[model samples]
Target: MGVQDLLKNLLDWVANLGFWGPAAFIIIYNLATILFVPGSLLTLGAGVVFGVFWGSIYVSIGSVIGATFAFLIGRYFARDWVAKKLENHEQFKAIDQAVGQEGWKIVGLTRLSPIFPFNLLNYAFGLTNVSLKDYFLASWIGMLPGTILYVYVGSLIGSLAQLGMGERSRTSVEWLFYGMGLIVTVIVTIYITKIAQNALNQKIK
Candidate 1:
């Protein structure tokens, strides 16, 4: 099934479980990360089902937990394999050393940068000296803004889906307002992340 269908079915099944439903969704989202699923979709799904406030909360929790789990998996189970693969990787070597001096800042930048590989970075951090607590905190903070932006967009789409666009039809000015808002949000977010990434690269160099 497509992601939306899968999420819709999961939502329906979990809804019948009463108070356990939201918690179950969060757990599922967390576990899905381990499988290398597109967590952005899950975050968007959360916003669709839970609205912006709760969606951001759950996504944050799940993301941090999932990343930490990935870190541990690399540290204990796959360290040897990861090490060998990264042995000749100069970028990997640079990040490792950068993490040594910058700690959470580097981690935070990695989280913000769109070009950074998410799952691999989680594992890569494990080989660094950065503490788990530090990693979690930085990842949480750095990931939050983008999470909010995505969740907000999802919530808007969800609202439109449910309300038939309501007082905001296709020809309405509100549609234009929302369209511009999304475009601006995405551009600003990308710009900021790129700036931060450039600064980080310079620092590491």
Candidate 2:
């Protein structure tokens, strides 16, 4: 099946779990993260299913757990394998060393930006000298704003569908509010990313 079709099926299955849906979502999300799957679609699906507050919470929990597990696997279970995979990538080699020197600051900053793939970063950080505690805290905090922004967008889209796009559509005030919020989120994300990129460059020098 196509990737979208598979994701849709996964979401449908998660939604039908009723009382177990949230728990199932966490497990699925964790597994997906470990499997090197990009989670943007799954994260958005959570927002559609659970609304903003709960969706954000669940995604955060699942992502952290998955990242920790992936890190552990990279560090202990398959270090040689991960090393071989990244050995030719000079960029990642530099990041690996930078993270070792800078600890959670590097981790936190990188998390705010998409300088590297999320799943790969999870494994790459494991290959570094950063402590588990530092990684967990930095990742959680760094990933929060982006998580909330995506979930908020999903919630808005859900609301739009439920309210219908006809005359009963959202008020202009609501539209303005969402628009401003999205703009602010984008600006803040970009600002943090710029800072992170600069820090990364300095560290690499």
lDDT of 1 by residue, 97-177 (tens): 667666787788667655566777788888988988999899889788778776776676663234222343343443554
For candidate 1, the 10 contiguous residues with the lowest summed lDDT are 160-169
Top lDDT prediction, candidate number: 2
Over 4 Å off in model 2, which ranges? 159-205
66-96, model 2: which lDDT tens digit per residue?
9999999999999999999898977676566
RMSD values for the candidates in order, in angstroms, are 6.3, 5.8
Task: Report residue 30 deviation for candidate 1 (angstroms).
Answer: 1.1
Q: List the residue pairs that clash in candidate 1.
A: none
**Runs with alpha carbons beyond 4 Å of true place in candidate 1:** 2-8, 85-90, 159-205
Clash count for each candidate, listed in order shown: 0, 0
TM-score of each: 0.72, 0.77
Tell me how many residue pairs clash in candidate 2: 0
What lDDT does the true structure give each of the candidates?
Answer: 0.72, 0.77
